[model samples]
Target: MKSTIAFLLTLTATLLSHLPTPSDAFVYPKTPISNTVWKPEQDVTISWHDDKHAPLLSSSPIFDIFLMTGADDKQKKLATIASNVDGGTTTSVKYHVPHVSPPGQIYFLMFQTKDGSGMAWATRFTITDSEGNPGTLRPVIPEGGTINPGGIGAIISSSAKHRKSSAAAAKPAAAFADRTATAAGAHAPVKAANAPAASVGGGNTQEENVVVGGASSHKESSALKASAGGLMAVAAVVVISGLQFLGF
Candidate 1:
């Protein structure tokens, strides 16, 4: 009886060890294949498969999806595709791609459980512009570092150029105003000086006329005095001749 009981217990232990556990659960991405290509502002579908042992509705009912780039060691998260998704009922989700800067071919999708228990990554894919041209990814710039002149950098450069052109156009107008103000200031003094000079010239002319008039009056008075003296002498001579004839 004891040996049979020990044998039954050993059989039960062996069966229980082979059963699936929470650690054995896994999610597999399916939609983003190697040849898949997406465009900005396009609505795309992403799908995945979960193992039977996965806690789809129990421990992890919600999932999160993300767009990723680079290798596993240096992977970078580009954007969040979906969040709080029901993993038990649906295996696919739709996402609208935004206008991402620096479009490239080194993109992939990652599906993760809400509890961070299990995750899966899709194959590499491509993202192109409206013209179907493959673009380079923007390089990761460190803090306080300069960005390369492309993608977002190109947009910033264009904006800076526009501001510079506006400032350049304003410079000529400012300089012209300054020159006008200076010309006005210089001419104002000249006008004031000319007015005073004209008044002084008129005063000097009046003084000169007064001096000439006084000299002419003095000469006329002297000539009149000499004429009167001559008249008196002629009258005295005529009287003396009359007296000698009458002998009075």
Candidate 2:
């Protein structure tokens, strides 16, 4: 009788295992298959499938959707596509894809219940601009490099160094120009000093007046010497005439 009771309990447990459960509400994403390409600002319908055993509507009524990137382990949330969605009645949600910075090929969607009970992750896909081109990824700095906040460290450093070098090169040129100007100023006074002076009166300077005075003095001395020599000759002639008159 105990064996028969044990067999009956085992049969009941097996039957319960095959029954449907609420935990299988959303098990797989269906619309955004692998390698699907999407464009920014475009309307995208994200859909999912539930297990056959799942109920028509999930127990959780509200849901949230996110645009995610990167690997599963290091997934980065890009944006919130929808919030407070009615997940109980529908298996799909419509979202307008926003413009993502550094757009790449590794993008996916994540759907979760409001209470964080259920979740569904879609396959990885590509997000391109309206021109159908996936944007380039931002550059990554290598090891042991200087880092600047809110910017690319290596690029910023290189640009800063270039500006510094340009400034350094300009300093010597400016200094040389200043020195040239100073030397020119120093020589200006000398040039002014050597310039010919303006005549005071009658177009003759003080030097010309000195030369005229010297010529006048030399002429007066010569005239006086000639007058004395003539007087001496006349006196000699008078002396000779008196001696003849005496007839000695």
Which one is best on lDDT? 1
Q: 119-229 in candidate 2: lDDT tens per residue? A: 556655666544456543222212442210011001012223323222222222112221111111111101122223221111011110000000011112233234334
lDDT of each: 0.42, 0.40
lDDT of 1 by residue, 1-248 (tens): 45654554555443333222234235666777756788755678887776554564444356656665443222344556776666666677777755432344455655555554555557556665544555544232235422111111011122333242223222221122211111111111011111111010100100000000000111122332333344345444555554555563
TM-scores for every candidate against the unseen true structure = 0.43, 0.42
In model 2, the clashing pairs are none
Model 2 is weakest, by summed lDDT over 10 consecutive residues, at 207-216
The worst-scoring run of ten residues by lDDT in candidate 1 lies at 206-215
